[model samples]
Target: MCDKNCSFDLSKRHLLKLSAGAVAFAAVGGLPSVSYAASLTKEERDAMTPDQVIKSLLDGNQRFIKGEGVEHDYLAQQRTSQQGQYPSAVILSCIDSRAPAEIVLDAGIGELFNSRVAGNVSNSDILGSMEFATAVAGAKVIMVMGHTKCGAVQGAIANVEMGNLTSLLDKIKSAVGKTKFDGERTPENYAFVDAVAKTNVQLTLDEIRKNSETIRDLETKGTIKLVGVMYDISNGKVELL
Candidate 1:
């Protein structure tokens, strides 16, 4: 057999035609074969210790801060995760655009189960989802992440009311009492806002512990570990506890 670079005998061989797209990409590294690319063979989800899971998030945050990330295949990962997801961790975060759990953590599909709500509140449903993530979906760790300068935290702080938002903000009211800093408690109060964000995550963590029996059992047996973190949007780093 001739080498891959060997030319075929022109007089004896028939011409093999290539598609326009293929010919166009022939100058480059070769256009990706759609049929082959669509196949989801590399479904290896890495194993991570609970502590490693936490550290990985922090490292990813650092990458995000530096404007670097592992931006990868979207459709391929989605197709692979269509049937099942083996995420390494579960993140309960506030539904703030600036605080997106996946991008800030530099996570790819099937990497972490993200549970987002206003103030990252842990009601029965959120707890249930987290329970499913760890117990059923095989997530090794759970994270309650809250961000700085949060509108929800401010709304709760200011006691703003509109539609059902009253009730949603009410869930964050507990953090006000938890904010026992040496200064005032208002959004203008940067120290207070910062404290509120931290307290909110810690509070949500407690709520998760209090509300979910399944998660509690998992935590007790060390099958899963729970942690709280505050994401600073300005600097893009997670302060984990």
Candidate 2:
């Protein structure tokens, strides 16, 4: 054990072992801990401005497009949000299951107040909901999201009528007339349909501003922003208008 060569080899081995342990510790430390929790708390929501809320949605959409959406613990979020919810935005979207606003935007529970209807059209009831979500609940942004290849747009293009759906589609008819498209102007023309859909979203925004004094006042005072977006079902992309 006292031989010079043997002593040197032993010291080298011990140094190597120590280095390996250090490397392992560093690797473990680099990993995100299981106990690490990230949720949109009331304070966090309250700290964000209307523009910041819109930027968050846009950034989330980019993550969604990249297939890198945030991993959320739904049960934990539910338990934590039980005390109260401080959502930042209210989204008016179509009833189509393919274009869920929360999923496309990569938003968590208690992050947005969602209002769904056949064509994402604003009526008296929807306007009232928007006012409550913004003026009462402190939502900072109002998003009217439409989708390409929407069945409601197609129905409006073809004038399809069935019970309550007839009245609902009637609201979208004005958009069809207002959309300036040189195409065939039929349900068969998808470009025309999508154009009309976009027009529908704009019309809804106009209706919201015209119908709800509370929402308009909030927007006028810089407390909230009204925006329109189109979600493409083909590629899962959201384009702001």
RMSD of each: 12.9, 14.7
Off by over 4 Å in 2: 1-39
TM-scores for the candidates: 0.79, 0.84
Across residues 87-177, which tens digit of lDDT does each residue of candidate 2 receive? 8899999999999999898877777899999899989988888888888888889999999999999999899989999999999999999
Model 1, 1-241: lDDT tens per residue? Answer: 1222322211000111234343334324453323112211112222234655566577778768888665556686688668866777889888888899988887766677888888888888787888888888778789989888888888999899999889998988998887779888777887788788788878888888888889989899977889988888888888875
Best by lDDT: 2
Candidate 2: which pairs clash?
none
C-alpha lDDT (0 to 100) for residue 36 of candidate 1: 15
lDDT of every predicted structure (CA atoms) = 0.71, 0.78
Candidate 2 displacement at residue 99 in angstroms: 0.3
